[model samples]
Target chain A: MVDIPEHLLIKTAEARAKALGISVEQALAEMKGEAEPTTISKEPEVIDVKPIEVKEAPAPAAAVKADIPAEVDFAPETRVTQRLLTVVKAKPIQKPTSEPVDKVNTWPHLMLPEFISLMAMTAFLIFISAILQAPLLEEANPNITPNPAKAPWYFLGLQELLSYWDPQIAGVMIPLIIGVAAFMAIPYIDRNKDNKPSKRKYAIMLWTFFLAGAGTLSLIGILFRGPGWNWTYPWIDGVWFDDLLDWVHFE
Target chain B: MKNEKIKFRDRVKDISAGLGDSLKESSLWGSIFRPGSPFRKGYSDSPRNRSYVVMNNVLYHLHPVKVKRHAVRLSYTLCLGGLSFFTFIVLTITGIWLMFYFRPTEMAYVDIQSLQTSIAFGSLVRNMHRWAAHIMVIVVFLHMSRVFYHGAYKAPREFNWVIGVILLLLTLLLSFTGYLLPWDQLAIWAVTVGGNMASYTPVIGAQVKFALFAGLEATEATLLRFYVLHVLFLPFIIVIFMAIHFWRVRKDGGISGPL
Candidate 1:
């Protein structure tokens, strides 16, 4: 037979304590008391009867056939049993079980109509495109200059900027520098770990100011500035609206 | 027999305990496959958690979950701001299609005439390409403005902002090059004035002009060079920067947050 090591015995005691949903320290203390009966008798006032019953019950069953003297151990068991009987008699009785009933469904499932409408609108657009036969333009005319050799409408804003400063600086360099500076500083400027938009005040203010300035400048340039370096005063050349009206009349 | 049964029972218990320990040691389920299992519960499961499952998921990694949603919506004006990019695509396709029927020599003027009259929808294609190029420039500017307004140019994203600025320049370069391809008198004078501006760039102005015109004046070589730059070089460069711009957004915790 293999001898159980001291460490294994401790581990087994701990495992048993955990299985019974009790603390290992409590189990160990009770086991120590069992090893020395005189120690328990000397401090009988301090001894916990509940833990003693739990620990002693499992041990006596294992020790009964091992020829341990019954006189020393029978006293504690008898005292524990008498206390448990009195406690059980003092408790109120629990009621017996009743019959089971079937569960009734209270909630109904809901269907979404918004999703159906979206699908219908998408199908309608597709159908309309198929029915209308719009012709693509003629071959590319590299030679024939259209009457108004206009830059795309969006560039009209930047082209307007070109009217105020050098093309290299105003149209290109300033924009480039600003873009670079802004991109690099984003992480550092908004370092707060907050994800909510309302929490980030400075970042919002910065964006708003940037948008207003760029939009206003670009819009003003597009509306007021004409082609090339011709910075004719509105009083001399007439307002842009008058010029547009005159052009319309000529056409 | 009783001794043998006791020995077998002990061996089984030991083996079961050893297996349980090995399972815990190897982290068979937690480490091998279960995502973010070892970490604290809510911390790993939060949608904004960048380090956990996002590090492993192939597609989710492409986009940051906790983006400055307001910034992106306002920045590019949602993908309708992508209309400019779409217009660029349109121009490229139409430009290449036009090249099939048109030539770059002094004969380019007559070739353009033949293309309009002979080729089906040829004039329409040219008009669309021209209009689209104009639209693209406008859209790109708007897109840039959107980016700026959102403060997307600040830190970490600064390089992408620079890339965007370069892309804006490339857009203008594309426009300038395409301007000369028409081979008209207007194209001639415009290019001449533009080329002269290149010559006014202080030192090496003449050299820059020479490089741009490919000679003393805007000739066949100039047209070819402009065509290549407009269609080939600029597009290639812009695409590279555009990819970097998008990837950086994912890296920099998605668009700048609201102030």
Candidate 2:
């Protein structure tokens, strides 16, 4: 082995490091025949290994697998699992659940398009009314009696009912009583389980009769009867009958 | 690479100048656009906090606690039995509008006449209100019929049915009270006759009549009574009933039958 000067050795090491694109310390360490450079401060402190107490996770997967065998076993049973097995069997047979089926097209389910169209039609009607300033008859001149100074169309039916009976019985009392009774009876009267229109025959018929009777009676009373005091008319002459009819014309 | 760096530096300088100009411009814009700014408190963005924002809201009770989507869509759409409810909202709007100009006095008849002829769109408002009122009655009847036909009033819904009956009477009362407000000969006579008829109720007829009219004849007091009943009293009753009605629908398995 030949001896070399420390300064020259350091210069040569620097040159070699630059050429190799390595750090000076790396080259120096390699020249010294060291396996690894003393770069890191110290070996990382070893952590103590303690035994872990691990609780097993719930056996959901095993339970699911077990359920199949349990179901298979249940399938052979006659009484105990019959209903449950039937339900389970049915689940697989059924198509996947989707959106609900609409049974009767009731009022609350109006589509946006239909609602818009309805609103448009209503608006158009209102516009036409506005444009026309829809003629209003002379301000209900009480002194100068008009021929058919009638109640609005809806009340005309009730007005007609006034003609046939006493105002107390026919006009106010009877109607009120009947109305309250009818209203109270609604739930009781139509207690069928069926929601289909076809199944509700009696209910439909009863309602139809009620509507017709109310509307027809009101129309007849309003149209035929004359207004206020002294019921006898030239055409429909009986005094009491005319009085009854006049009672109906109050609205 | 040198050229690119120079270009990048110039771009950065340009961006910095632009940003400064924008900041200055924004200050001027802010000054110009500034209106009277009210003081605002910081609020929590959590949903539970948001819910309390409308604690005193009028429409809080309008909606039921729990609603099945199907029930809402069905009840509010299609055949539109629920459209009657919308009509009621319209009635409320138009009614309040009418009240702005109307005086519920003995002069109500003449006031109505003036509204018919003199006020702008007054007759239209009146007519719409009148027609809507009538339509509401018809629609309600039809709705009841539909409910009956569908067997929606059975079992747990029986109490609701009873409530519905009360609602129907209230609706009729609303119509009747409104009718007397016009105070024309028709209104006067109709109410007089109606009052007299009440006087025939076997035992409490006269008392009922007196309570209703506030006197023997249908006078200013009667008009005021009817006005209060029409606008305030009956409305309160109906609203309370309506809340129960809607809530019951939710509780009773949401309109019945299979979904």
Best by TM-score: 2
What C-alpha lDDT, on a 0 to 100 scale, does residue A184 get in candidate 1? 48
What digit string (tens of lDDT, one per residue) describes model 2 on residues A1-251? 77778788788879878877778878777777784534445445454444455454367766666645554542232322112222244346667777664442221122233456448535754654354332233332335544444554455575566556776677567666787786687677666766666887887788789877987776465444554522334345422222133234333
Cα-based lDDT for every prediction: 0.56, 0.61
TM-score of 1: 0.49
Residue A129 in model 1: lDDT: 31
Per-prediction RMSD in angstroms?
19.1, 23.7
Model 1 agreement with the true structure over A1-251: per-residue lDDT tens digits:
56668687688779867765666776665556553221322322333455343335566577664676556564354334222223356654975585333221110000012223334433543343333322222323445533333343334455556567876665456554565555444656566655445666777687678767767765554344444434434445433321132222222
Worst 10 residues of 2 chain A by lDDT: A104-113
Scored by DockQ, the top model is: 2
